[model samples]
Target: MRMNFGHLRGVHVRVFVPSSPYFPAYAQGQGPPPMVQERFQSVISQLFQYRIIRCGGAVDDDMANIIVAQLLYLDAVDPNKDIVMYVNSPGGSVTAGMAIFDTMRHIRPDVSTVCVGLAASMGAFLLSAGTKGKRYSLPNSRIMIHQPLGGAQGGQTDIDIQANEMLHHKANLNGYLSYHTGQSLEKINQDTDRDFFMSAKEAKEYGLIDGVIMNPLKALQPLAAAAEGKDQGSV
Candidate 1:
């Protein structure tokens, strides 16, 4: 079935729930029951309405593709609205992470990144790259930054090429971190040489995030108040 949310008009979300192969009912061709499809569609519609994107697990090409699409689509739907991204990732694939980062900046809507748990390596980079003054982390979340990790198992020439590419990526990433965190290039390079971890408060002091979210309700009060004010004005 096609699901369309009011905020996400013109965006047709198709819910496809494949029948479980192991289920005996499926073997008889009684497939993905209507209830399952409705549930999936409902969740998708809600996510569209809320404009919430989640980045969990490793940052790979597939994950990056989805995020980029979501960011672009949401911006097209409503650029005035802010997009909230919840990041809890171990980090992987520098290219993939860069894709998401660039798209986050390229879009018209402001992207607010929240570190719900651990944001390590490229994950930390993306967390820091969010719109300035909007990056946040939960009180107990952990953030880590380090150089890109890679290995080569080929001929000497191939290994040399791979090494040079890794160095290039490391330099670019260091520059990005310096720009985002207002830290010196030398300091960023030094801290990222190894696995440098920080608590949420430490990350805020280090300039990786604007604030540590100690109380979620308090943090959201401004938005709530703004909405209430708008409602009152409309009335």
Candidate 2:
């Protein structure tokens, strides 16, 4: 599905993963031990079983692709299921985050985003873009939003172009914040002008998350039920 970033220039992003039709050496007994491979497979299986995707490192094209694929795969397998995304990153590549942020809103299955560590900049954007009431953060998680950064080389013309791009990008980001957090443009602009940081509770107060997660099982119950309800309806 196409994404809408409103007034921001559209940039095509691609996610690349090296793959082959034939089995790898690992599967052919030339790599890790079978036991190790089994453990690796088991861990991967658990991710799909729980329908959870982790975005722990800096956000980039690869992470964005993986997330979109996971979300799409989950929806295809069971459209009514919930996809839990745990984010812990300093955030990177605004374009990359925008891809995931837009996909989170476009997907059919409900998405619950949990901040396990730090969700700064683009990470903060993704956290707030979660399925509204399903947005969450751990007790100790930190959330932040700030203006975009840029540096230009070449000549003055190149520098001017980069500066203009940052301005438009900031405006688009502000609009995104207003749409998701129910905050006005003025307030979002004021807060994001600096390196704004907040604790989980403070984030909730700022309308970034619905609540701070205290008990995982209890906190996820409603989301689970909602997914099941969708499943039953589809069936």
Candidate 3:
């Protein structure tokens, strides 16, 4: 069976499924429960919507794939539309975070990140990477940024290589921070040398976010203004 679902930025979503051999059994209420099947279908339908992407737990490769897929989908369907990314995470695999961070930068859509709870470490990196003047944090959200960490196993040579790699990652992250937040590499290094945490307002003051949003709709007003400004500039 094929199902046509909701649209995101005018992009139609379609899902396809093959007929089950036990269709008669299901019709007779002998296969899976109707409620369970409906719930499964509902979850699948939600995947097609691209207005928002949630990062609620640790940011891993699975989450990275979802984030990237949504961004690419949106870019393909409507490159100029704005997409919201909601982040509430304690941070996770640096590589996974980098995948998301890099994809966000590469995509054509303007990603507006909203930090709803905690945006720590790599999560903070992503929050800060949102399009300039579009990064936001709810009034009560917490934001944090810290140095990258690594663990090594096996021979001494392997440990040495891991140590060097960790240093390289640290440099990369610091450079990212500097570029996104308009901070210097020296300042980012000093701030991230330890676990640094801040309130939403403080993060805004520190340039980690453009503002602390009491109401997200109000925050979006700038996007319209920005668009107008761009049009005026190009004319």
Candidate 4:
């Protein structure tokens, strides 16, 4: 059976399932050697329940570049599918993460995001960028939110430059958070002024997440599929 992940942002979602026929043809290696392919598929299959995809430790130009590229690819591939994004990261570049947030918002996916382990800092922004029905960690998983930080050298001049850039990030971050979580901009600003990590229960209570899922990594796609099916039934 073919499993469709549905659509996001006018783009129909697609998954490069390890168990598919495309794997053998496109997976060239060094990417795989002998029985390595089977083992690799097994491992990836274990993770397959989720739309769980990883992001870099912090936002960087590289990750920004990826968000753009992936957006384009998703656009080109399908325009009527909803996309589910699975995230776990300590967070990285603010500029990069902002770009990611913009990219996600522009495309109007029936987006849903889940945090399995660490969705901290800018990563939290990405999590909220989801279209709706956001979910998060239950047990040991965490979600951290705080003001953007920057690296500065030299003296006053560097500090000024960094501060200006930080203001820009804060504006963008708060805008995204306000729209998705329906919290006031001032409240988000206050919450993020200091780094805050939320437990699943706390996140749900504050509307940072829609619900809490146990063992998120293992249930990513399956839950999405189930939800999709449920939505279809209701329709």
Candidate 5:
């Protein structure tokens, strides 16, 4: 659940962590969409249980810098303990994502990601940034990919020029995804031409994630009924 903070005067856009049990301010983040607030929140809860620190959302710096700082701090505090990152982001600048992604790849800590809602654009790239033993969303959750699009205001010639830039951008994005996913560069380029969104099941099949995690709370009632049936059979 979220509210319109637009009414506030002279407001500075800051990412906020929603209070636990009811993540209200979560969807109102700086780096990504707020829809998967619940899923990201769940990952945070899980990480805290293991004593990993949470960080980020520092004003105009794209937030990745803040995230990196936090991870480094955690490593210093406890060199032996592994860290988990719960990322729910639509992605920001390429430079920012690359920095954060590199931090995850090179950091000595154990970094795992749970793509709760949607990891679109550079956000999906960050998911691919996880070191190893990564997890993903339930089958219904979305994962998307594509090149960054710049806003344009120009004529046909300018449009053609932008198209060329788009092609180059696609090449760069494919280079990274192909290197990580091991898919053909041609396939990655083709897929990013248009927005490609995959369900968790599809992501697993493509080797994007280790597996899909069904919402256990949503399945509780059915499991309870199955348990009751077994008990009645014994009776």
Candidate 6:
């Protein structure tokens, strides 16, 4: 069935159920039934209505493109509303990560990032790049930062060229970390020379995140109350 998620920029979310006679039955516990699949899609649609975006797995071109599109579309829908991005990535492709980081800053709506698992390398950079005073992490989440990794394989001249490009990108990334985390460029360089890992509390201390979310329930109360007030005021 085609479900029109009108609130999510009119995207049509399709839930395809296998009609083949060979399809396993739910009674045999082989897979979820069609109704369950539809419910899963509905849950995702509800999350979009609240402007929640998930950046999970690796930071790559496809992931970055989808996130940037969502951010821009949501901002167009309501610039005043905040966009909450949940990040749980191992980090990949500095160029792709930069695209996402830049779009987060370029959009009109504030982007609040929450780290739920591991935010390493470029993932850490993006988490730290969230709107000031809005970056957060769960108590057990981990964040890591390090110098960009380069894989240059070619003739000597080509390798040299790639090395130079990598160095340039490294400098740019360090500068951004310094700016966002209020750390000196020298400090950032020193720390990132080796893999630097931080728990949520340590990340907050290092200025990578504004706060560690200790109590999920209490943490959501303020947001829920604010939303409630807005709804009543609108009526």
TM-scores vs. true structure, each candidate: 0.77, 0.77, 0.74, 0.69, 0.62, 0.79
Task: Give lDDT tens digits, candidate 1, residues 1-235.
Answer: 1110011124676543222211113334455777885776676567657887778766777778878988999999999888877788878778888999999989998888788888998889999998887788888899999888877658899888888888888899999999999999999999988889899989988999887766566344322222233221111
Worst 10 residues of 4 by lDDT: 1-10
Pairs with backbone N, CA or C atoms under 3 Å apart (clashes), candidate 1? none
What is the C-alpha lDDT profile of model 2 across 22-67, one tens digit per residue?
1123333357677876786677667667887777666777778878
Local distance difference test scores for all models? 0.75, 0.73, 0.72, 0.61, 0.57, 0.75
lDDT score at residue 59, model 1, on the 0-100 scale? 78
- In candidate 3, stretches whose alpha carbon ends up further than 4 angstroms from where it belongs are 1-50, 216-235
lDDT of candidate 2 at residue 216, scale 0 to 100: 56
lDDT of 3: 0.72
Off by over 4 Å in 5: 1-60, 152-169, 215-235
Clashes of 6: 0
- Residue by residue across 102-179, what tens digits does model 5's lDDT show? 777666766655565666677677666565444344456677777665644589887777667656655776798887
| Superposed Cα RMSD, model 1 | 11.0
Give lDDT tens digits, candidate 4, residues 64-131. Answer: 67556666555556655655566766676665676777777676445566666777877777876775
Local error of candidate 4 at 133, Å? Answer: 2.3
Instruction: Please list the residue runs of candidate 4 whose C-alpha ends up more than 4 Å from where it truly belongs after superposition.
Output: 1-52, 134-139, 215-218, 226-235
Scored against the true structure, residue 89 in model 2 reaches a CA lDDT of 72
Between candidates 1 and 4, name the one with more favorable lDDT: 1
Worst 10 contiguous positions by lDDT, candidate 3: 1-10
Using alpha carbons, what is the TM-score of model 4? 0.69
Candidate 2, residue 157: lDDT: 88
